[model samples]
Target chain A: MSARPRDPMLPRSYRIESVESELPGGEVFSWTLRPRGGELEVGQPGQFNMLYQLGIGEVPISISALGEDGTLIHTIRDVGGVTRNMAALSAGEEIGVRGPFGTAWPVAAAEGHDVLLVAGGIGLAPLRPVIHHVLANRERYRRIFLLYGTRQPADILFRKELERWRGRFDIDVAVTVDRADASWRGDVGVVTRLIERGGFDPRNSIAMVCGPEVMMRFAVMSLERRGVPARQIYLSMERNMQCAVGYCGHCQYGGHFICKDGPVFPYDRLEPLFDVREL
Target chain B: MDDLAQVFAEEPFFSGFSDAQLRRLAGLARPEVYQNGRYLIRQNGSADRFMLITTGHVVLKAFVPQRGMVPLETLGPGDPLGWSWLAPPYKWHYDGRALERTEVIAFEAEGLRQAMEQDHELGYRLQKRMIEVIAHRLQAARLQSLDLYGNPAGDLP
Candidate 1:
């Protein structure tokens, strides 16, 4: 028998309101979406959507930000078959949408604590919404620190936004590049080094990190070294997610389904499962 | 107090050094500057001097067969430049190039070595700090060589 009508498993149509190339290379882009109906709604900071191109494939991308005007932002890197199709399309094109699925960054619980957002490369996409939320409710958090690391000056994303955030009195942002050329004046090293430069009250700090698993591992280690407990750190994990609703085991790790249970999890919960290498 | 000693007294690399110790070390140091594109030290060159950078930055680089002058690490103001002088052979392992208009407090390796030999206390503190810097750079190289971003598992490009 077929599944019931209006099934959560079924995809909904959403129009690509606009798309901006994220870098000069044109491999990555930030797409703004407007849903055709109430079928799929923008979810939480760390939640994701399964974007389906009619003739191609469907892939998961995090909701980078929920625009004040009600549009959803997705920063996608052109990778496998599906994303390539989505990136080549122009405005006014319709793409399939399903969810703002999975758990979100613990912004609510992080209130009243010093917030540290550590992101690497495209990892910044999933954490951008958290940054917007904290700024909107600036009075709730004690202090906000953002430490972002990318490959080089050429790979930096949202350049203007980073400059704006860097100018804010309340937000402390540190950026590092893996390598630097003649014109690059910023710190040239790993992002973890910024944890030491960032002045956060570790006892009252809650760190949210989104990056390559390798980078996040070191990030958590550095946070722990700085006296922030493991439970106080959260990271967003990326895996091959097919079903947004956890039915397919494509995104399973250590008996936990990344689709339903989390894309964000406390460092303590992920510690043993992380570094498992393709598990 | 000498201006160089005053600066050294406040730097992290020279932390734990008493004002008296800073003054003693500063005597063997001279001010030096390098323009952009100049090499502070070349690989295999005799490490006659070690430096404490005061302004601008220098990059540690190595020349691979196929890659020309690949940058390994960058050292900014308040960072130390050469550790090869502290070890035997006393030859640099990489090229240090000025990334900008760099100002440095250069210490004669022979003079500092003699001073350390005479003052065990000063030698112990300075040696420990140099070891830490060396260890840090070694770890950075290891991490960078991993190429964490190039093939990050599950990360989309």
Candidate 2:
């Protein structure tokens, strides 16, 4: 909860306290980082941080969860050389960390309404914290729904946590996959389709959606069809963020700098530019 | 029959039908229930009927040679199941099973086909709705086939 450092670009040295495999084949990992210098800068739900891999590179990864003892939990997919290298790092290895940056999900503002979280693939990582916050304040929200869809049963993230959440009577969690083999017994479809079956009161609900741009566009369309207003819906945008502080112009969308102005924005704010392909 | 007509009138699928059309269609429908794990339609079986799911879930699955049943999609309340009944050779391509005790307003495809042939307006309206359902499902299937979530570019920040 502390303020960011005076020089936003100055990356802090943090040692990886633990490295856990989040998915099979070690394609994805959850790394818990502890600041070697001081306390961890815990990010709000939907906020991302710039993780520097020494001389290699830095990529912006959303904070997946906050460890109980103040460590930062980041769920990362090994898609690039930097992420692949980071996955190879063992516990006690040091990496540069900056931010906890960008706008956050309006979890507090959504207190009195039905909270619907729609995620696809790795998009679930950013929304996991919002789920934790809502569950922690269970009584404040009327209903909470998490609709997630991934590529396959094998690609599902947070399997145990999803099962545990499903066990709770207060929250509704529906998981689906685009495809599955014979052994899988779950729903098979795009994440957007789950919106229709979510059974939330869209009129009084606030929806937070995160996924690929195409998936998010379809999700927004589905939410709108269910009567959720543009103002009540939020989306997390991903862009190439070289400088996490917005100086680089690498993550600009129209006039908004994703790093500072948003990684999260109300649907209404982006309506004009959302469907424009060349942006 | 009046009660069945009311049910059809209330369903989204039958939304624009006239009162007379609903009454005629209702004559072809009868209520059916399947308990959990019951097979609603077996693969290669005659697709003699289609249903308007009133409650519970139906999973459409295809059987693999060495593997077991692989689920293709799950349809629930307000969803219409089985379009194969409208086409020739009317055979189910996949098996539809109830994941829970399911209630549906089952329509006799043979009777409906006869009625449609007699009443062209009713046939056109019904066929249009079915086409919409088919188009929507086709679009969803295309999106699913893309494996959009599996695209590595989705992870790039």
Candidate 3:
């Protein structure tokens, strides 16, 4: 008989391998974790894990990338007590991790179609895995576009990666900033403006967007204007998730639990609840 | 200027204009080119004309005393460049600079305004379309001011 999956309620210890600050003030950073247990369960793109900070608290963080040596990576923005404490952790420090939970981006189903990824600020972390996946299986898709927008030039995430992607011939990458300094020479506007110049065939494209709620709302409108069906577009959602297993009522949205049923959902499925006031 | 009329007809901004209306607009338009770093319009300068970018980019900027030129937005090909010509005082509020070798169809504001007064139907259609463009830019500006991406709240899954 097949082995039953391990209990997700219990947390597994993971040692921090390295910590790199992604932004100027160290408010945003990435952590490479090594499982104290045998092997780490790799999370698919858009899936998240409950990162427990010992006795302090636990927060759900999206898996940014999967290391070749069975390690897991997560990029976090330090905002709350839990995240601020987690950011204080150094290499070799230990943190508890549970799950590779929730739904994933429809990478496999996107085969044979054009793929568009729109990310804003820290939202790019969750979509990075999908970018890696598509690039690994490049021949399976027709056209690939990555349009990223940040609050300012310094706020841009994965600068080197974005540069390398921009250099690539197969995939199209565009970066924009809400506010530009004298040094920034790229596009200056909301990310939706990039959609106007993206040059992708909306009818044959599958778009996955992760960003601020208002930005995503405007992006959906822009994508619809470009003729992409609502069903073909997806969004990564965020909420206050406590259990990460849907047991707690914290992350419930309308009829679904973001911890279990989503975190990633097609726009059509969430359209009804998307703009509903105070939902 | 039949060729120019065809170009105007092709632009989404002029989509509702009748063929005759496009021809009338084309009569007031003349192709102009600006090299990189050239100013298309200056702050508090006469807004004698407006432009429709045919190629390259234009950066909208406002100069601050300590910070120098701060870019507000970048307008690309097929984008409208100025609306200050439509109102009283008729002076540009900010600076418009060519980010690259840009080609634009510059329309004589005085001629267009006179035509609009004589042809109310044409004026109404053009004004309505301009209002839409203005509204879109206003919406974008509102979203930008929110600093949505900078807020760390709801950032985690």
Candidate 4:
């Protein structure tokens, strides 16, 4: 039998058009990338893209939002080596991309139901695409609720978008901070408290959450306690992803590979992995 | 009046407080228990409360798939669990799990904030104490990291 050829590391090439500091806070950085020549794959909300910094390394970053001009947007924090290198890249630089990987947000399934979006810190990057998709097809859903939490007032990502979402009648947005300075006048508690204050009918709502593992678990627990079914809740997970493809074991959580099986997974699928800690 | 009071009074952070202040602080805190493997604070979750370990040990863990639950540090009596509660965006930086059956005295963050608002002197004292605790932990972590990556000290006993 003939052996299958190994997949190439450079799956697709992307051109960086612009980089913008989306949040006034020092944490979030937004970048615009356009595929060179070839058409980019259409991605679902909650899906992620693996970005490689030419000479540095590749890291899995969630697609923040899609632009009307065909450019894919990514919101990243300058945390690790790969992201730090990415932040230093100027406009017109080229980077590598692997996929529009993982199962997307249940946008189609969520039609006709109220949708709740919960995000913490950099977790907002993954949930932003879902929000855009929901708002674009606004007529399909009954109501949309967004709850976001950050470490401090200055660290809130997507400040402009958050304000715009707050202005819209179709979506109710609530934000909280774990700690706040004198400038902050909003709720000064955990994001879970915002969910309690939002008063959504969990029975009729599908909740999507992204953030650090701890925040996602607590958010899901809070939602479940409010009557939201585990099956209806979706969570975006973060893991050290080497190959965007399933071949690498870096992103594995129990039996599932976060890169291939999901960066987005139903809450029930996450249950067994929750206590595993390392997943 | 309670086991928690006895433990709280002995903590280094409470050493400077007068007996009356210590009693008041104890009154503002509540004792809680956790079984082995229970999470006290989850990574990236809101850190709206602060906990002081009274008995047993808890592991400060960070999940990195390759190495599993990377034990960042093992904390025991007198250590504070959530420093983020002292600063804004009070989100937990990492997950804290009880390595054994543990008891803790948790101070409600909002109540502390309210108390701070009423008494600046008490607030300053507490904040200074908390900062010192954070500094000590950071130094300990740095030292541990050095031990992990530093040159070997030859011919150990």
Best by TM-score: 3
lDDT for B58 in candidate 2 is: 87
lDDT of 1 by residue, B33-109 (tens): 99987999999999999999888878887777865666667777777899889889999999998878999889999
- Tens digits of lDDT, candidate 1, A1-279: 985656667788889999999889777799898888763475999999888889788888998889777688899988766777777899999998878789999999999999999999899889999999999999999999989988878888888999999998999887888886645656778888778554689989999999888788888877887799999999898788988788999889898899888989998998888778768
TM-score of chain A of each: 0.96, 0.97, 0.98, 0.94
Question: In model 4, what lDDT does residue B125 have?
Answer: 83
Residue pairs in clash, model 4 = A151-B89, A152-B89, A178-B89, A178-B90, A179-B88, A179-B89, A179-B90, A180-B88
DockQ preference between candidates 3 and 4, better one: 3
Deviating ranges (above 4 Å) for candidate 4 = A1-8, A24-27, B1-157
Stretches > 4 Å off in candidate 1: A1-6, B1-58, B61-71, B76-79, B91-108, B115-128, B151-157
Fnat of candidate 2, please? 0.60
Q: Candidate 2 on A140-247: residue-level lDDT in tens?
A: 999999999999999889999999999999999999898887666678778877887757898899999998888888889889978999999999999898887889
lDDT against the true structure, each candidate: 0.85, 0.90, 0.91, 0.77
By DockQ, the candidates rank as 2, 3, 1, 4
Label model 3 with its docking quality class.
medium
Candidate 1, residue A78: Cα displacement in angstroms equals 1.2
Writing each residue's lDDT as its tens digit, candidate 3 over A194-271 gives 887657899999999999888999999889988999999999998898898999889999999999999999999999
- Flag clash pairs in model 2: none
Model 4 chain B: lowest-lDDT 10 consecutive positions:
B148-157
Docking class for candidate 1: acceptable
Q: In terms of DockQ, which candidate is strongest?
A: 2
